[model samples]
Target: MATVVFVHAHPDDEASQTSGSMARAASEGHRVVLVVATNGDHGDVPDDLADGETVVHRRRAEAAASNAVIGTHHVAWLDYADSGMTGWAQNDHELSFTRADTEEAAQKLAAILREEGADVVVGYDWHGGYGHPDHVKVHAVTKRAAEIAGTRRYLESSMNRSAMIRSHQAAVAAGLDVGDWDPSAPMDDGNPLGSPEEELHWACDVSEFLEVKRSALKAHASQSDARGMLEMPEEWFAQGFSWEHYIEPGRPDGMVTGWFLGEETVG
Candidate 1:
């Protein structure tokens, strides 16, 4: 059983992006470790917090609940402050993950990777699925961390742009309400969502684990997006989130349907 370490930028990111894979890995008896780079201090502020409870504390508790739902074996936090969206003043904070020195942050994650004996280390794509500032930093730091730790396989978690567009078109054709979300529209850093289909390496079909994913998302109730996702139509959620995409750097272009272990389960 190989160990897979998923490095994320915030508390609920793993639930949104890689919870299925994490659940699958744990179910298969492979160790699953989650390393979050930030405390998520700048995420949505829930009004129901206890007297002295801060967003960071609440977010970390949410992450712990999420990890339980996903069957994650271990979790680590870099404890950096959240760097709010691109232009937000939080980005300039000395302790923000976005403003952290790349090498230093990488070292922190590399230590976790080494300790976990990670065979496969997962991170976000270059634009971090929507170009969020901390997410982009996660990409950079994870890349450097993987190199520093000499991990055997490095996979980048990402959405499949063409696949998303196809899913959206199908939804529209079926008269489903997709709201204002446009896959081709500019995101946080003026980049379209995720990488092109051709750029992806594999599509892990986690359809069977959809319930597990939803439960994990539900654990992060403090985040507005997570709450919104839980309220989305079940069919829509199944259609868009059943398959998680990834890019294995240096791999050839064509996409394959399989798990991250390089085993081809389906064509």
Candidate 2:
């Protein structure tokens, strides 16, 4: 079985991006490891803080629950502070993931990759799907780490623009309330949310693992209200998330029908 590792920027990013594949990997008996880059300390601060509990502590707890739901065999962290969205003062913090030296952070992630003997490493897109500061850092670090560790495969997780357009049309036809965020809008850092569908190289049908993905999403209760992912209805969730998209840095080829590693995992 493949030792697949997914590197994400924050706690709930795994839920929003690659939880389905993580669930399916573990279920298929492949070793699955998740490396979250930050403590998510800058995430939504709820009104009710239990005495001295900090946002970092709360997010770590949520990440643990998410890990269980997604069937991740192991999880590690880069131990960096969360960098808030673009233009936020948190980006200037010395401890923020975005401010860390790329090679330095990559060395840390490469050590994890070497330790796990990772066959494949999943990371964020070039613009991190929406150009979030931490997510962008994750992309750079994961790429460098994969190279440093000589990982067999490196995939940048992304959204399919055409698929999203279809999803929006489907929601309209199905009479479901569409999400609040506009997928087409230029995000932070002034880049489009995801790569064009034509530039994508791989697509995975995670429908079988949708239930686990949903559980994983629910596990991030702190962001449930702040984020729009879990707000959608069951059917819409399936339609919107059933297919996960990816890009290959080495190859700009069009997408092929396959899972993260290959077709063998399906059987």
Candidate 3:
């Protein structure tokens, strides 16, 4: 079985983005490793977590639990500080992931890839999946490391514009709010088309994995509130969600799409 390593910008990003594929991969016996780029130290904290260090420690524990739920064997971090989104001003911090030397970060990730002998390395798209500076840096570093290690690389992303539009329409039909999701934003750095077509390499049917994903997201109580009851019922959540999308490396002609079969079948 191939060893697949997923590089992410924060603690819960794995759950938020790729938990289904991770679960399916591990269940199918592929060794899965989660490489979180940051400690999520800047995440929100509850009133009970008054101690600063304690909050960090708690978030780490939550991340660990989430990893376990997703069937990941290893969860390592680059141990960098979070670089809040661009234009936040705090991004100017000396130690933020955004400010970290790209070469240095790439070297560090390359070392991990070498030690793990990872066959497949997954990371966010160029837009960092949503323009988060840390996410973008993680993508850059993962890309560099994959190049250095000579391992196949993939970028995790949502559905293409048509699919996303359909999903949003479905959500709206189900009484879910679409006001917050902006479909017009540019998905990546180079693409000006805004909502350009996405090449999905693997579409993992993670409807069953949604619970695991939700639990994982719930684990990060600091950054977000997990108590929204949307129009889509829990049952719909299980059945409606069909795929975890991806963008493969070295394919510039267009978006290459497929599904993860827990093997090197090249779906």
Give the root-mean-square deviation of each candidate in angstroms.
2.1, 2.4, 3.4
lDDT of 1 by residue, 112-181 (tens): 9999988889999999999999999999999999999998889899999998899888879999887898
Listed in order, each prediction's TM-score against the native is: 0.96, 0.92, 0.84
Which one wins on TM-score?
A: 1
Candidate 1 segments exceeding 4 Å error: 262-267
Q: What is residue 109's positional error in candidate 3, in angstroms?
A: 0.6
Backbone clash pairs for candidate 2 read none
Once all C-alphas are superposed, what RMSD does model 3 give against the true structure? Answer: 3.4
Worst 10 residues of 1 by lDDT: 258-267
Residue 58 C-alpha lDDT in model 1 = 93
lDDT minimum window of 10 residues, candidate 2: 258-267
Q: What TM-score number comes out for model 3?
A: 0.84
Q: For residues 1-267, what per-residue lDDT tens digits would candidate 2 score against the true structure?
A: 789999999998898788888887888788999999999998888677799999888889989998998889999999999999999999999999999999999999999999999999999899999899999999999999999999988989999887787766777788877657566778898987788888898888999988788788788888754256777777778887898889977775788768756665322
lDDT (Cα atoms) of all candidates against the true structure: 0.91, 0.87, 0.72
Q: Summarize candidate 3's per-residue lDDT along 1-267 as a digit string, tens digits.
A: 878899988887777678888887888788899998887777777567754556568778888888888889998889988877667765888878999999899889988988998878887777676677898888788888888888765555544555666766787898976677645546334332113465555456777677777777676666663323223477655544445677765555454444544434433
User: Residue 71 lDDT in model 1?
Assistant: 97
After TM-score superposition, what is the CA distance of residue 205 in candidate 1 from its true location, in Å? Answer: 0.6
The full ranking of all candidates by TM-score, starting with the best, is 1, 2, 3
